[model samples]
Target chain A: MLAAARQLLVREGPGAITHQRVAQEAGVGRATAYRHWPQPDQLLLDAMGGADLPLFKDPSAPIRTWLHRQLRQMADELEVRAVAAMALTLAHSALWDPAIAHRQAESVRTIIERILVATRSAVASGELETEISAVDVAAMLVGPIVYRTTMQQGTVADDLIDRLLDSIGTWRD
Target chain B: MLAAARQLLVREGPGAITHQRVAQEAGVGRATAYRHWPQPDQLLLDAMGGADLPLFKDPSAPIRTWLHRQLRQMADELEVRAVAAMALTLAHSALWDPAIAHRQAESVRTIIERILVATRSAVASGELETEISAVDVAAMLVGPIVYRTTMQQGTVADDLIDRLLDSIGTWRD
Candidate 1:
């Protein structure tokens, strides 16, 4: 069932995952699919649990390089038709509800923590302006990408990150 | 029909809006509603035209004051159950789709232009950091807020903006 769910999510996008479709796609009985996973979101969360994100690596690389690489990975995720499709459905469905918001905050905080860890070194090395929390910096980095992603897909140009770093006097090879 | 649609959006959310509901709510026949709006999106768009947003104001006020005031207004809007309700539905339904994304880009660009205009003035007055375009400054101000808004519902804390301002050396009395 899980494999079927992952296959469906990756192959067709989130909107295509009805119980009947999953059953047919997985070659299982309809009742079996519903019994195992009642909704697409539950199945999606299960699938996302094991999917890999591009890990930040090469500490020897310049901070700007690392940042841009990380951003590019996010852009790739956003541009994926299936991921974007499912994400949009989830956003509309239960993501913003109070119950889900409370449950997800813990995970979101963890994601921010990972970003803060990377940014702490940049601040120490004078690559980032001091005084602003690493959290805000993460927000600054991710915000425009998301804004462009939802407001205008694929509108983030190549020069934006470099320009922002330059403005902060942090741009360097 | 528009009034009915508006009532449905505010009362039951965008998902609750259908030709049947609007017709019943407006005391009109179904054909009349369909004739007026071939699609529900047209009605929804019309209903959203007059939403009162917290606009940037007080030209003489310090830039930080103006920003904080503007942010407070956004927080207010986010907290409004109905607006948030409809926004989430719209986000899922069409906002992330390719067609809506292309159309929304120009308006989003205009919003950015307004922020850039404000940031340009602040740069001249030594209120904002130099060398960065107003566009980057605007991104800094907006990214975190939107991140918090979408990722965690209404998690923009009262002091978070101030901390960001202070960190960026934009904090002023």
Candidate 2:
């Protein structure tokens, strides 16, 4: 059922994610689909929630290297149809309702938390320096990738990662 | 009709902006609305296009001060329900269709061009220095505000403007 919902989202937009359509796509009865997920938002959220992309591998690497790899991974994933669809669904729904906003924040917070781990380790090892909170740092680094790819409808050039790292007050030995 | 569409967008999200509803809101005939905007996307686009927020007032200020003011203006405007609604509508539509993507890029480009005007003047006047293009600079400065407000459902702090300016290689005596 979740698979059908995701497929519909990728192929069409959120408007297409109806219980009837999803059940048909899943080869199940509409009643079964509705019984399991009565709310459309719940169905859409569950589908998107289950479709998590793999996070950056090896958070133990040098901070700059790890950031570059992680951002690149994010850039690549945004190009995927399902990922972009899910992101747009969450973004569009989030603004209209506070409940959706909380859910969207939860998803974004998890991603930023992973970044905090890398930055904390880097700061501890004297490999990076910054006064801003980890959230702000994540916003500075990851925000551009989101802006360039999702907002501007453009790809993240490899050099962009370098420029971003340079601009963010990283330290050298 | 555009006013009606804008009202619907702000109050009820994109789902509420239909010919029948907008015509009713505008106190016009449904046929008139349909004649003017046969397609829903066209109506949404026209309504959003007409709802442009005022850009930064003075572009002649020093680059850092100019960026700070401009970003603060943007942060404040995004808090406006209509502005955020239009932005989310464009963003959600852009991903599903390339035609919508082109339209979205045009709107975003105009805003970026204004930023470029400031940065170009600053570069010529020696008030600021950067090797990156104006687009990347705008992304670095403005992107965090968007990420903070729309993506994270948070407000932009004044210090964030200072941090962004400091990080972006601005020069000072």
Candidate 3:
């Protein structure tokens, strides 16, 4: 049932995730699906949390390489139209639903923590801008990709990572 | 009817702007509203296109000042919760609906053209990186504020403009 929910979410955006629709897609009874998830939002939260999109892997790796890899992974993920639309759907849903917002915030906080871990040694060594916060760094790195993929519906260019890094004035190689 | 639709959209997100709800909000007969807009997407597209939220004004102004002013204005606008939610709603809707995507693409193209005009002299004079596209520059400049305001539900700090400019390596002042 959860897999069905995730498939519906990724394929058709959040609007298609009602108990009846999910049950139909999962080949289960409507009453069974409703009993499992009284609210569609709860079903959505679980499906999103369990969706197998990996990001920011190996946070302990060198900062620059780790950052580059993450950006590349994001670009690859967003290249799929379904995945990109799902992201935008989740972002939009997060606005009106506190539960979605909280879940998203938890995931974002985890990613921010990973970014901070990678940047800690660089900041201590004066290699990164000391005044900038981890949140700012995340925004700087991830924001453009989000804008390009979700807003502009454009591909994340190869030069974009270098450009973002250059703009941040960090980890030049 | 359009005014009521805009209000419903800005106040409660896209899901609230059905013909029935909009007719009630506008104190008109539902039949009249349906006659005018047979499809809800038309109403949404019209409302979004006619929204009075100003952005990228005075594009002929000097590049640096104009860019900073635009960013500041965006921060101010997104500071309003409803406005930010509307933006997310539109972004999400644009994915599923081709009409919304077309309207949004027109506006985005206009903004990108404005950015290109502002950067033309700088790019020619080598004051800015010649290799970067205006769309990339726009993404780099605007992405962080969108991230902070919509995704993070955080305020755009005064220092963010400088940090973004620094990241783009254009217009340090």
Candidate 4:
């Protein structure tokens, strides 16, 4: 089960997400686990996809404030074991397989889409102005977070969010 | 040998970087490889570190131009087989071993140090100004590239470099 995969990832790291360990943890036969998820990477992806991090909240707030809060929340979540699994997923994604890399890019696109929806709302609400597309703005916000996390510096500073927004060319209503 | 290790990583992926494969590739006995590296991760680190990346050139040029050229060179190199090998080393680096992670962190620090030197030069020349430390400005430069690379995005946009420098509070001398 995905729960078993996630628990193993959190408790033992990415190497422990074998089908056998997950099946054993979930009280399922090895064949059963393999029948649904063929490779450990598939199970690992499912588990990372299912991590229960907080999401965008306070939609009524100014767009910049809402985004800042969302990023801050994401930073807080990274302090936990979930970040270890996510970090491993992001890092090892380069398996030299185009299929795998495409899948990884698609998954990243999903997160970017989530940010874009809010950014569009910000644009409509007069809290933001930018020459870049919403998609590029999302990259501007999330790119540094991924970078800092990969570097293992363990914190995304408050000013980083400010700078990222400033770089996006935001303006007063 | 490190050459053998790099060959396996470029040809295959991180999963292929074992003592046996490296030894076989290098025309040496497995025992000989083991005597040198002992652990597969150590071999992986050596191979990744040994990649022939282009480094900073023309330090006498304006610091911003020199720094941008360095990032651009790094991006150009990412287009080759070296990226596959480098990506694997970064991704699978989180095999849940603190000792291994610590060792990985130490290796990463070397590269960050290189970026810091250039950024410090930029600051000292008044080509850039920021409340953030030079170490962080380096992160701002490197993070987007890593994020794009990890996502399998083929290019780091030219404007991304521009925006990053802009966000760092760059100014005319």
Candidate 2: clashing pairs of residues: none
RMSD of 1: 8.2
| TM-score leader | 3
How does model 4 score by TM-score?
0.68
**If scored against the real structure, what TM-score would every candidate get?**
0.60, 0.72, 0.73, 0.68
Candidate order (lDDT): 3, 2, 4, 1
Candidate 3 collision pairs: A167-B167
lDDT of 4 by residue, A25-60 (tens): 999999999899775556767776554323553355
Runs in model 2 with CA error above 4 Å? A1-47, A51-53, A56-58, A96-102, B1-47, B51-53, B56-58, B96-102
Q: Model 4 off-target regions past 4 Å? A: A1-45, A50-60, A90-103, B1-45, B50-58, B81-85, B94-103
Name the DockQ score for candidate 4.
Answer: 0.39
Per-residue lDDT tens digits of candidate 1, residues B1-173? 77777777566544556788889999999999889988655666556543222255334447777777777666555555444545555555564465544444544565567676766677778777655454545555665676667654555666767654543334333
Once model 1 is optimally superposed onto the true structure by TM-score, how far is the C-alpha of residue A33 displaced, in angstroms?
A: 13
Real contacts recovered, all predictions: 0.47, 0.52, 0.65, 0.55
TM-score of 1: 0.60
Ranked by DockQ from best down, the candidates are 3, 2, 4, 1
**Model 3 residue B164 lDDT?**
86
Relative to the true interface, what fraction of contacts does candidate 3 keep?
0.65
Give Cα distance to truth, residue B160, candidate 2, Å: 0.9
